[model samples]
Target: MKKKVAKFSVLPVVGASIFFYSFSTNKAQDINTALLEEFKTVNEELTFEVPYSPDAAVFDPQLRSYPALGKSYVAFKEALGFKESGGDYKVINEFGYMGKYQFGRGTLKLIGIRDTNLFLNSPDLQEAAFYANASRNKWILRKDIERFEDQVVNGIKITESGILAAAHLAGPGNVKKFLRSNGTNSFSDGFGTSIKHYFKKFEGFDTSFVVPDRKAKANSPSVI
Candidate 1:
C-alpha cells in the first residue's frame, strides 16, 4: 500500500509539471508571434520612400509660380494685382470694387465698362479696363508726375509709377491734393489702404507702356 500511494503521488506531480511546461511553451510562442507582428509593422512603415534632398527643400505644387518679370510693365501690373486681389480676376471687395484692380462702378463706367457682370466675368475686359483707367489717371496727373518725380515727400522718393499707383488708390484729384500738400492731405480707401502706402509700394516700375489719354476707353481699339 505505501508503495502504491507513493507512485500515485509521483504520477500527479509529473502530470502537473508537464501541464505547466505546456502552458509556458504556448505563452512563449504567443509572445514571439506578437513581437514578429510588431517588427513587421515597423518594417513596412520604413519601406515607404521619404521625400529627401541634400538641401532638405520641400516644393509645393499648389503655389503660384513667380517668373522673372523684373521691373517691367508686366511686373508692375502683376505686383499691383497681387496686392489688390491676390491676382484673382473674379474677386470683388466689400466696398463695391470689382475685378483684379478693384475698380468701383463709377470708375468702370468712366472707363466704358457698362456691364458690371460682364466686367467681373471677363478677364480680358478687366485687363483692358485697368489699362484705360491707368491711362486716364496718367493723363490727369501728368503735371503732378512731372512736378513730383524724383522729389522726396514725407521721406518717400516720388516716381511716375508711384504717382500713377497713388492716383489709382485715391483718384487723380485726391492724389493731386496729397502730392501738393507734401503727403499731409492723406487719403485712405474704405479698407484704410492709403495713397502713400501705394506710392511707396508701387514706386520705380516701368509704366511707359501706358499712354496717357484723357478720354481713354476700355473698349477703344488703342486701349484693347
Candidate 2:
C-alpha cells in the first residue's frame, strides 16, 4: 500500500510582539506539520496549546480518519443540510445553531448573544460556545462522580462506556435507566460508543468545543 502525505506551507506574521500564522496547502502531512508548527509557535507566544501530543488510543484510523468528534459534527452537518444552505459557515440555523457544534438559539440567548447572525459569523461566539459545551461536560462528569462513584471506580463495569457516553450525550439520569433496562453494558453498545468516538476529534482541534446541552435537564428529550 502506498502511504499518502501532504505538503504544508506556513507564513508567520508578527505584530505587537505576537505571532499570527496562516497555514495553507494542508493535506495529511502538511496539516500535521502545520499543527506541530502552530503548537510550537503558540507555545513560544502563549505558553501552551494542548500540552500533550495525540496518542495511539486517540489517533487510530477509525477515529482520526473518520469523524473524530463523534456524531455531533455529523448531526450538525445533517442540520445544515436540512436548512438547505449548502453548509455555509456564515449561516446560522433557525434554532440559532452554528459552527461545527450546532449550538441552539436558547444557548446563545443564555450567554447574552442576541443577534443570531452575528453569533454565527463571529469566531468569538464559536469559541465561546465550544468552551461552554466542555464546561457542561465537566459539570456532568462531576455529577456522575457524585452519584455513581462506585460504577466509575470499578473500571466502568456496572456503568459501561455506553451508559457513560449516553449520559454524556443525552443525560446521566436517562443513561442510568437505559443501562438497567438493557441486558448490555459496554461503552460500544449504546450512545456511549458515539460519544467516546467523537471526544477524540473534539480534543484534536482547539476551535472545537463540546459544550453540554444545558437544555439537557432532568426530563429533557435526547434527540439533539
Candidate 3:
C-alpha cells in the first residue's frame, strides 16, 4: 500500500513539472514574438520617416564628398565659384576681385551694387549681383552667342554658357573680339586665366535661366 501511494505521489509531481515547463516555454516564445514585432515596427517607422527630394543635390557616401553636379545651372555656378574663390563667399583675391564669383568693384558698380563692403558681406546680395552681372553679360554677348554657338573656334566648340563665362573672365568686348577673329583676340586675367580656358572649362551648362537684359541691376525687382 505504501509503494502504491509513493507511485501516485511521484506521478502528480511529474505532471506538475511538465505543466510548469510548458508554461515557461510558451511565455518565452511570447516575449520573443513581442520583441521581434517591436523591432519591425521601429524599422518601418525609420524607413518611412526620411524625407527625399528629386532636385536635391546628392552626396557620395563612400567618398564623403560632393560629386559632379551634372550640367545644370547649379553646376555651372558652383563650378565657376569653385574655380574663382574655391566657393568662399568672403574671399578677396590679390587683384581686388571679391566674393564667390569674383566680381571687380567696377563690375559691381555696373550691376548697381555701390556698397562694396555690403556686397562682400551679404551673400544674398552677392548672388543677386552674380545673376545681374550674368544677365548683363548675356545681353552684351547675345549676338556673339547666336553667331558662335556650336561653332568650333580654335578647335574648341563655342557654347552659350562658355561665351558668358569667357565674358565674365575677359569682358564681353574681348569675347566678341575672340569670336569674331576666330579666337585670335584672346585675353587673359591677372592670374593668366585665359578666355579660351574659361570657354572650354564652363562649356555645355544650361544657363537659360539668365535672361538677356541690357539694363539688369542687382537691386532691380526682376533680378532679386
lDDT of 1 at 94: 85
lDDT of 3: 0.88
**TM-score for each predicted model, relative to the true structure:** 0.70, 0.33, 0.70
Residue-level lDDT for 62 in candidate 3 = 75
lDDT of 1 by residue, 1-224 (tens): 99999989899899999999999999999999999999999999889777885885578788878779898888998899889899888888888788898889899878877788777888888888888899999999999988989999988899999988888888999988988998899999888898889989999999999999999899733222
Quote the RMSD, in angstroms, for model 1.
Answer: 8.8
Give the poorly placed runs of model 3, Cα more than 4 Å off: 1-62, 65-68, 220-224
C-alpha lDDT of candidate 1 relative to the true structure: 0.88
Stretch of 10 with least lDDT, candidate 2: 4-13
**How many steric clashes does model 3 contain?**
0
Candidate 1 wrong stretches, greater than 4 Å: 1-65, 220-224
- What is the model-wide C-alpha lDDT for candidate 2? 0.43
TM-score of 3: 0.70
Let me know the TM-score candidate 2 reaches against the reference structure.
Answer: 0.33
